[model samples]
Target: MSLVSKFATVGGATLISRIFGFGREMLMASALGVGPVADAFNLAFRFPNLFRRLFAEGAFNAAFIPLFARALEEDGEEGAKRFASEIFSTLFSVLVVLTALAMIFMPALVTTIIAPGLAVCVDDPAAGGNALSCAMRFEITVTFSRIMFPYLACMSLMAMVCGILNAYRRFFAAAAAPTLLNFILIGVISYALWIEADKATIGFLMSWGVLVAGIAQLAMVTLAMRLAGFSVALKRPRWTKGLKRLLVLAGPAALIGGITQINLFVGQAIASFKPGAVSILQYADRPYQLPLGMVGVAIGVVLLPELARSLKAGRLAEAQHTQNRSLEFALFLTVPAAVALFIIPEPIIRVIYERGAFDPSATPAVAAVLGIYALGLPAFVMMKVFSPGYFAREDTKSPMIVTLVSAGINIVLSLVLFPILAEQGIAWATTLSGWLNAVLLFLGLWRKGLWEIDGKLVKRSLLVLVSALLMGGALIAMMWELNAWLQPGDAVTTQIAAIAILVAVAMAIYFALTLLTGAADRTMVMRLVKRKRG
Candidate 1:
């Protein structure tokens, strides 16, 4: 299969997952709205989800895949299996202890780490009689956090297995496994809505659904590994050189891998001071995540293994070309997506989330946050593209330092802005910090002579920006034309149809302009589609 073809396999599955996630979020918005229950649920889920991102996406992808590829290359199948078994046993033991401790100290974790602002709610003069309500929300958050903490263990194990699959170029099952979480949650939320469950009941059911989904996701990927003729047997945990090396690499890569999540974690911590802020930021996050997951994630997953294998084989030129093409592909899709989201976030948010208990009054706030996030969309994707250059070479420390600096900037900016702009300030802080991370990663690669901007890549990038801007202009015009049908009080079908027309028009204009201007061409695209893996 071509490299792009491999990317397509993962991207297609992620696209499916994102679509299901949209459904889940839509239902969640209707059921919980931007109320206290919604805040409790989102805050609770973020705690485990943060760790899931760190372990599953960050640590494993950054540290595990390249080593697994090395095991396959040097020690053959038997050695790789032994390595996997050893790592599996050790990881399982650690997760068991971690999950137990986290659950036992759930209340402290909730009040101190997850959201310290919630702890002071009862003491606030502004809270008054609402003090009791705040206390209840605090307890609900703690309960939900405990219920879902075990999910971190399931996801961490699943990530290790998925890393093995990626090393073997088996990407579909791992890419598709996330859809199961959305599927299960969608069903749970649907059932709640059908039976008219109250907010607290809905929150509890959804938290349990997360744990169940994590288990199912692990089983699916594990089954895929077995079907692919690979198995890691349970064994006594042993401290081996390989395990020691993985920890050494993973310690730094974890931060590099989870920089985006870390920034969001910080934002969530601060946003918790105001009711509905956490849920508002989350609602805004879903729309942009579609493109990020489909394009950025697919590139990160596919590019890392490919680059590692190329570098391992001493194909220096091939590795450089892979980096260039990955960046090109990432920008080609995400630039236009960012443009669309920035231009029409209000209409998009309204169509997806404006019904039920989600008040029309909340639309502008969410839209503002979404627009700011859209501005950072390409930066986020670029970080995904550039970080692999370091990781493929087993140089996690450089990116780790860059991530820490960016994170500090995010923290400083969030504190400076949140008091002034509310949630939008958090959005601004995240966006600015993202661009800094992307820039530093790119410069690190270039300074080391690991990557260079070829003329084709440079030319196409500029043209892609132009094409996206042209599409954004057209979208503004169309929005003005369709204003009557896109209103909040308009019929749901009418609003959806209007948004659909806008999206269809935007895609057509963007693709047409890219083709006309040679930002992308049929020959180049066909080569990407048809070229086999080197």
Candidate 2:
């Protein structure tokens, strides 16, 4: 498939997943908001969710995709399938052990790393509010964490299946699988709400929903593999040559993949000290993640395998074109999203989340954090586009070192900023660290002469920025025009209409300027679409 087609396929599926994710979050806002139960749910979910992203989405794919793609290219189908099976066996064994051990020591993990402040709140009888309630919250968090930990194991295996499918050029099934999680969560949460279950009971049900979703996603992708004519069967663990090499690549990649998660860990740890900070960050984070996941994940998934294929075949120019275009595409989409979020965060937050327990008082804090996170959106998406250059060549150590430094910077900054700016400081730290990582990755790529932006790409990128700024200006003006309708006391319909108008206007202005300034590649997009349809 053409790059655009591949992106569209993955992007289309991701859009669905992101939409479902937004629905899930909207429900969460209404159901939990920023209360104690919400805090508990966020903390509990972050535990397994962190590891799942770190290993499944980050490390496993970084190491697995290039190697697996190369295997399929160089080896016959049998050889590739054999390699996949062996790697799967070893990975499953390891994840099983890790999940078991973590579950056994769930309490310690909660106290030491996940939510230290919750533990503090529980231990200090003199602390204000209900000590019993605080203790119950900690206990529920631990229970939910234990319930959700197995999801990491399932999802890591699911990611392996996805790597296999992506290498085989079967993108839709893998890309579509994540939406199942949202669907399941929405159902579980909605059902809980309909039955009027208590918050703790509802939290437990949602925790189980995570596991169910993991299982469903795994099954869906596993079936995709079989239908694609790939048999990825389990066998006794084997320490094969490919497995050893995978581990070598994965060692650094594990750290590289964990960088974002580690930053999140830092933010969550700091936020846990202040009640409701976790949920506030989570709510603020949800909207930004829509663009990030849609642009970043789609680009990352499609680009990595393509780069691996091109580089393995010694198509240096093709590899460079792929990198440049991917970067261009990311910026083209992400810049406007970042601008919009930065300019009108309050109305967006209020419209999407200011209902039920998410009162008007919560809007400003979440909006502030959302705006800060907006600054980092491009960097985060750029990292997704840039890191594949190193991974495709099996040179993970460079990105790993850069990720370690970026993570350290995030932690130190979060600590320093949390006291001064609260959760918004953590958001700033994430944004700054993302830029650090993106810059370092580019520097490494430059030093190695692996890639460079052509003059045209740079010019167009500048045009993209200019267009986005114009759109931002237009959006800000419209926001001013709709100020009364955008306020908290306005009817929900009015608030929604104001946001819809602002976004529609912003998009129209941005795209019109992009075409007029020659920032967009209309002919290329049309050709890709024609070829895809043909």
Candidate 2 residues 335-412, lDDT tens each? 999999999998888888877667779989999999999999999999988888999999999998999899989999
> Which number leads on lDDT?
1
In candidate 1, what are the lDDT values of residues 1-534, reduced to their tens digit?
887788899999999999999999999999999988998888888888888888767989999998889999999999999999999999999999999999999989987999877887855837543877888889999999999999999999999999999999999999999999999999999999999999999999999999999999999999999999999988889999999989988988889888888989899899988889999999999998999999988998999999999999999989888889889899999999998998889989998998788998999999999999999999999999998899988999899899999999999999999999999999999999999999999988899888978998999999999999999999999999999998878988999999999999899999999988888856966675575543
Model 2 poorest 10 in a row by lDDT: 125-134
Cα displacement (angstroms), candidate 1, residue 296, comes to 1.0
Q: What Cα-based lDDT does every candidate model obtain?
A: 0.92, 0.89
lDDT of 1: 0.92
> Which residues of candidate 1, in runs, are more than 4 Å off?
123-129, 526-534
Candidate 1 lowest-lDDT run of ten:
525-534
Model 2 scores a C-alpha lDDT of: 0.89
